[model samples]
Target: MALTFHTGEVGVSRAEVTSIVADALRREAFTEALVATYVWGKGKRGTPRGSGPATLQKILAAEGLDVALAAAVTVLHEHGSQEAYAALHQQIPELGPSFFTKFLYFTGKTLPPANGPEPLILDRVLSLRLRSLAVTVGRETGHDPDGSVAAWVWADWNWSPHRYGIYLSFMHAAARQLAGTDSWPSDAAPDLLECALFNSAWEPSS
Candidate 1:
């Protein structure tokens, strides 16, 4: 069966999704925002929660940027292992789920997996969109839509280390199929598939 995505207006071809993703990737402001978030641990525009960049700067100051970076790398290396994730939370008790996840996202973007897809941003918008996709993909693949993986990613708000590993696997498969060709745009990257999905879900229909 050919893999496809619903563009919220009509069923969009993979080629169209790839084109939208590619165009988004080429935007200077988009790339700059990602860069700023990765380097500074939060962009100047602030988080989805409305917390300012200054808050992130304060956390970095308190945690020691180098130490925080090392911890973040360790968490990614472990592939979001429960132990590693816990250790990070313990190290920075003040960072709630939203901020911690963002921190992980930025670090993962900075140092992507050597063998697999990079860690995806899991903000509220993306998470909600992914939840919907999980149901669609699960049904298409004949998997239980409300199973552990889906529950972990879609139902639960807190990051589950074990489930996140499963979620990443699903994301990799979906992204590869969506790319539709061997030569996908380098700048776009597979992780941006979530961005494309988010756009489909929330962008005003034209």
Candidate 2:
């Protein structure tokens, strides 16, 4: 099956998700709010709790809606909880619908079609899909044959510098391992190490 990028809705992209989260962190403190909201909801509130839209707007203004959305996605995807989902929805309503649906379609429905791309041969070191690192990808570099596009699609575009650094480090390590540089041949060791040392980080998982 041919790869079809979901372009129907102007809903959240992975880059948007990362951006919202990163901006929220830099603003006031959505992380703390998120934790508090989660705890409060879990206790006795039983949903539809906290400062509501006004307070959420404050958080969004401090951070930015896009940033907040990204943060919410991270919280839900990484943590994986009904409460997390609730926490996110308590802020951004669209996420539970369109954004998440796109995410599901990519991860659950489209992975096999994606993985059909040819493997990255040594001499033909094409772009590697970042989703394969986190979820799944066909085979072409970063998800498609184009490295730049893959990076744009898969790297956490919304993370803070520190968070981005940490993520990049992991990606670098993963690339090295996937490319068979972890145990390079004597004559080719240095080249592999050089490629491994490159920034090798960008994009958001799509």
Top lDDT prediction, candidate number:
1
lDDT of residue 80 for candidate 2? 33
Model 2 lDDT on a 0 to 1 scale: 0.34
- What are the runs in model 2 whose C-alpha is more than 4 Å off? 1-63, 93-99, 104-206
lDDT, candidate 2, 77-150, per-residue tens: 45432222333343554222212222222221211112211111111111222334433443433445444444
RMSD of each: 12.4, 18.2
Instruction: List the candidate 1 regions with Cα displacement exceeding 4 Å.
Output: 1-35, 38-47, 61-66, 74-90, 94-110, 114-116, 135-153, 181-188, 201-206
lDDT of 1 by residue, 1-206 (tens): 22232222234433443344334334523322222443333332124553454454455455444465455556565655333444455455345444555444544544454444566545555566667666667766878655556556575355565545565676667666656455455345555666566566322222
TM-scores of the models, in the order given:
0.53, 0.19
